[model samples]
Target: EPEVTQTPSHQVTQMGQEVILRCVPISNHLYFYWYRQILGQKVEFLVSFYNNEISEKSEIFDDQFSVERPDGSNFTLKIRSTKLEDSAMYFCASRTGLNTEAFFGQGTRLTVV
Candidate 1:
């Protein structure tokens, strides 16, 4: 079965720096989302995109964060200025439809200092 794939299994960056996490979501999936887990915390939604536009976003997805489908198959999340609190596993998820099961990437672990 096809699955979402994330680049750089781990990343370490300094605070105030910028980072762009990349993901290649399932080709046929229509909905794409970004979620994060802060070490031991539950996964929190960041943003959802469909039809090349943001469908919904959580308050956590502030101006500092952005998502884009730079191409037909790539979904990416960029953190403008990294923060120590941003350290966590960021997951890329995609589903064929609202009710369909979502496929998640292995995740990119970001550690900011």
Candidate 2:
């Protein structure tokens, strides 16, 4: 079976630094999304991408954040300037269609000091 894969399962960074989290979803999946769970907090949807453009985004995905499918295989999330609040387990998800179940990657745990 296919599954999403994320790199650098753990990352530590300075409060004001930048970070890029990478993921590779199932080959045939179409809809891709980014979500995050802050320690002791509920999981939150950050953004969704389809057809090479952003389909939906939460307020959390502000000017500091961006997503890209740089090579049609790798999906990346970039945070321009990290903050303490930005520390969380970021998950990448994908689905075959609108109504299909989403498959999520093993989250990348980000820690900012």
Best by lDDT: 2
Candidate 1, overall lDDT? 0.97
Worst 10 residues of 1 by lDDT: 1-10
lDDT by residue (1-113, candidate 2, tens digit) is 89999988999999989999999999999999999999999999999999999999999999999999999999999999999999999999999999999999999999999
Candidate 2 accuracy as TM-score: 0.98
31, model 2: CA deviation in Å? 0.4
TM-score of candidate 1 against the unseen true structure: 0.98
- Against the true structure, what is each candidate's TM-score? 0.98, 0.98
For each candidate in the order shown, give its overall lDDT on alpha carbons: 0.97, 0.98
Q: Per-residue alpha-carbon lDDT of model 1 for 53-98, expressed as tens digits?
A: 9999999999999999988999999999999999999999999999
